[model samples]
Target: DAMVIQNPRYQVTQFGKPVTLSCSQTLNHNVMYWYQQKSSQAPKLLFHYYDKDFNNEADTPDNFQSRRPNTSFCFLDIRSPGLGDAAMYLCATSRGGTGLTSSYEQYFGPGTRLTVT
Candidate 1:
């Protein structure tokens, strides 16, 4: 199945608390990403690992980090979840085919909605 799935669809976190979200895929893809999307706004690219190459969005906050030790699993770690971190965290993956035109399309997970006080 070519799906990126996240667990616990909804997560409640306290202010300044830490949380971890998990993602997994069966696509055998080489690229995976984490995005943060707030209410009624465009999703912000957080970070991603393209195989062994790590790429981070310049605007992503320092509190957000990600790890992908292997091909099938990835994790997003929020060291200190603040109110501003309350948003929908989306996981995505892309198969390495070619240039942007061939491999740029990303498949998204159901997403985990984080709530912070």
Candidate 2:
């Protein structure tokens, strides 16, 4: 099955500690994205990588960062996690081009639930 995989489905970290969440995919999609979701709120797009180009949302906090070392793998690093940062971190991959006329479909991972205490 070609899909996204996230490690440590649940993570617990103390306030101000650094934590890293990972995502990998077998789909070989050209676009990979990271999103932060809290409860009923809509998932917020943190950043995405289209091949070697990195795009970050303007409103994304500096505390949230991502790295795509390769096509199959990506990492989200929280420099200093706060209690408010506890939420589900999702990694997604999309095929085709992202454009108004393109038919791009995004597939998401189960997500990593982070707990900051």
lDDT of each: 0.90, 0.93
What's the CA error at residue 95 for candidate 2, in Å? Answer: 1.1
Task: Please give each candidate's TM-score.
Answer: 0.92, 0.94
Residue 14 CA error for candidate 1 (Å)? Answer: 0.8
RMSD of 2: 1.8
Give per-residue CA lDDT, model 1, range 1-117, as digits (tens).
567889879999899889999999998889999999999998889999999788998888889999998999999999999888889999999886676545777889999999998
Clashing pairs in 2: none
Instruction: List ranges where model 2 is wrong by over 4 Å.
Output: 98-102
* lDDT at position 52, candidate 1: 78
What tens-digit string does per-residue lDDT give for candidate 2 at 25-87?
999898999999999999999999998799999999999888999999999999999989999
Largest lDDT belongs to which candidate?
2
